[model samples]
Target: MAEDMSNEHSQDDSGLHAWMLAWYDHAVSVGFIRPPFLLNDVTAERLEGYFRVGLTPVEGAEAFFGVAH
Candidate 1:
């Protein structure tokens, strides 16, 4: 599923997009009314990957989005 979507975007952007989606889903699941940022879908898959590796939401967000300056 993700591989199919990745075909439509450049490799770099595809990864970023995937992570953004995952973060959005996590935020929503944690009770945020909406995503913290615009995310615009391998979301479940990427989120699952993060969980499989034992990454907490904060860790995953930081790893993907980077720590805000």
Candidate 2:
């Protein structure tokens, strides 16, 4: 049962990761600013915290991962 729960959690995480990547790509394609770094360090919890603060994903990514050039 624990193994099954772990698998489910993994699947959910992968799904969220895929959605976030796709959303970021689309945002950039539409002229949203890209972050200085890759999304590799971003996590679901961090993203959720941004959401709770009322930022759109694009804004959240910029605020959390973007560096001034």
Q: Which candidate leads in TM-score?
A: 2
Candidate 2: where is the Cα deviation over 4 Å?
A: 35-69
What do the candidate models score in CA lDDT, each in turn? 0.60, 0.65
> Each model's TM-score, in the order given?
0.39, 0.53
Q: Candidate 1, residues 1-69: lDDT per residue as tens digits? A: 898777756764666556546666766666553645543246456655675586766567555555567
lDDT of 1 at 32: 53
Model 2, span 1-69: residue lDDT tens: 999999998986776666567557756765654665354444656875665566765676676557777
- Flag clash pairs in model 2: none
Span of ten consecutive residues with least summed lDDT in model 1: 32-41
